[model samples]
Target: MNKKIAASLASIVALSTLAAACGTPADTGTKTGGDATQAPAQKVKLTVWHNYSGDDLRAKAVRGQIDKFKAAHPEVELDAQAIPPDGYRQRLKTVAAANEMPDVFFTNSGSMIKEFYDGGLIQSIMPLLNKQTEWKNNFTPGAFDPLSFNNEVYAVPVNASVTSLFFYNKTLFEQNGVKVPKTWDELLAAVKTFKDKGITPISLGNKAAWLAQSSILSSLANRVTGTDWFLKAVKQDGAKFTDPEFVQALGLMKGLADAGAFQQGFNSLDNTQMEQYFISGKAAMMIDGAWALTNMAATGTKEQLDQIDVTVLPSVPGGKGDPNTISGGAGGGFAVSKKPTGKQLDAALELIYTISGPDGMKAVAEANQIVNYKMDVDQSKVTSLFYKAYNLTKSVTFTPVYDAYLSSQGAEAINNGLQELLMGGKPEDIAKKLQDAQAKSIGK
Candidate 1:
């Protein structure tokens, strides 16, 4: 047995001995159904903080799952606090400093998991999973990989947000006499055609650096190299970000920007504005994730919705990457605090199981959010081009989008350097700055 289980058994033995000596009834029920005695009942009220603002319909649907959990587990009361997505990381850090983190919380699966692991604030979900076989088998293998720290599972993934093709206005494409591009050269040709027709070839929102980092640069990285190379580079396994391939990727992005491929004022545009431009037929294509489908369906007309299309990104000529390779992973997953007691911890695990399992997966997917579980859901329920994007993502092996896979500080450094590069900083200068920051923060 591991240290935690051994200690828990020892404690239970001592407690049972004490109760027997005091002539009191021994609570001899086993945790894993053996001769071991049960731990004493301790009612707990857990506080869970999530960055699920009311404006996000998907977040609201997740909140509804929490409510269902509350109804089912009446003994455990949860105080669900919803924070805005923009400042959630800061808020979580502030709470952690106060030693006031909630018993159960929602967090990004990858870098956030690593940060909390380093801080000793989160507990491994492996122990809990050992007791819940059904729950353990529900998640896809790669889905849970991000939440593992030092080979131990720490979180349960709620959704898989993967990057895939986001093509714009079929009406505009047909009007401009352009077909959906299937190869990198074809894509460039389409861009030229759109430019000649006085329409923007793409809509890119670079105001928030990660947006551009994920959709364009990261997509190019995955295309130029395979997933393993990118992952190894991010993990700093004898790889450098200043390689010719990396430089070449950045140069390609610069070339596209210089050719009037992206919409005017792209540097100032936010995601919502870019989405609006696409829906209004102002841009011919937009590269984004599956989540945009939920947003588009909420606002666009039925005709407008029907005109949208999804496909895998085109394979680059002479590139090492596959056309089907996508950038994506599990986004928000559940993690319990290390400080909670056995019963409370078990309760929290139960809640996670309730939300991320089969029924919950189908419901959330029906609401247009991509799920990471392996069970089959009704495909007809999802009525948007988004499902096609999601299917394409699943059809390919996922390379970690840099923003999701890097250490938090490393991600910030790379994002900042990329932002400067987009705003006219030299590629070599940006590369040097990124390397220096990585060395300083992550130690070679």
Candidate 2:
């Protein structure tokens, strides 16, 4: 893998060195430096929505950039809302049907943004990128691929996300005399050990259906199906989701549930709440993406933060995929509404640049998240558990993030099916559902 691919948001953006690069107190990126655009005449009222309400530096990083834009453009009336992650997509969809998407909003690439673009509710960001030549040049090439449609960039990538990480508390592991699991069976045994000790083995919240698929099943499934099988499955080529390999991958998730690895009522919980269960010692481990690392560093107490470390899912028997690969890719980003034009368009463009541009990427990088930008951070002062997490990403390969690869209908079918799996639904049933939905999606 290339250095940029190896350096995911996982731990490549080490918190301590980032702290040094960002200042000990952390550069909030809220500084209203200088205007990137001319001051607006009439108050440019732009309603913006995003899913950065997590209790982490990632959220602060997003808001800080928004605050900076607000500060610099005093004449612009910017109404920014930090919506909950679980609800933002549905809420945005509802508004989009009414042609009421926020002038600026956080949006994931692929089908999510494509829906908006197809409806003429979204606008391309390439024009502004073309103007800021240096800023455009800094991003890792293909960073904008997911958001591009027929070469028109509808959005910009905000994170280089490795969608799944097996985060464990070292203190909990030591206390229970359990070492990190290296194989699937060992992982199951560790779950039994923790559960017997009256601790939740894993903290999971599937209230948002996507978490089970994107954060857990994506990476876990990859270990069984392998990248080659997966590529065929997505394209409905030689393999299908219902094939034995993919079925086995789905069974592993069911296996975790059967082992009682997750906390009670996990499906009823939200992802943000799940972090607290692990952070506060109620759970021994949490399976999440890179965002959880940012949350732990930003909110957990220093001592508790020190106890946390991350790893990839354990190897499964007869698995076809590389044990070192995790499910992830560049996904989350922001897009503009087609409603804006003239000065409003200029202000909206500036807003997008401010949030995902060079300065903006640096802000998020320091906030404990990684971006597609090739940064100039000094790694010499790194001294935290965060650095270890970065090393993990550097060593592994990233599998496809399902949402970024699957058809919208196929992605939804699997996401909802995962929720069903946690509730004791059949693995083969879910696999068959996905296979049918995806095959029909591609007319294959």
Go through the candidates in order and give each one's C-alpha lDDT.
0.75, 0.83
* Per-residue C-alpha lDDT of model 1 across residues 28-142, encoded as one tens digit per residue: 4336557765654444677787876644446767888888999887678678888876578878888888888888888887777778888999988787678877867877777
Each prediction's RMSD to truth: 7.8, 12.7
* Global Cα lDDT for candidate 2: 0.83
Candidate 2 lDDT, 267-298, residue by residue in tens: 89887789888899899988898887787777
lDDT of 1: 0.75
lDDT of 1 at 220: 77
Evaluated at residue 396, the lDDT of candidate 2 is 81
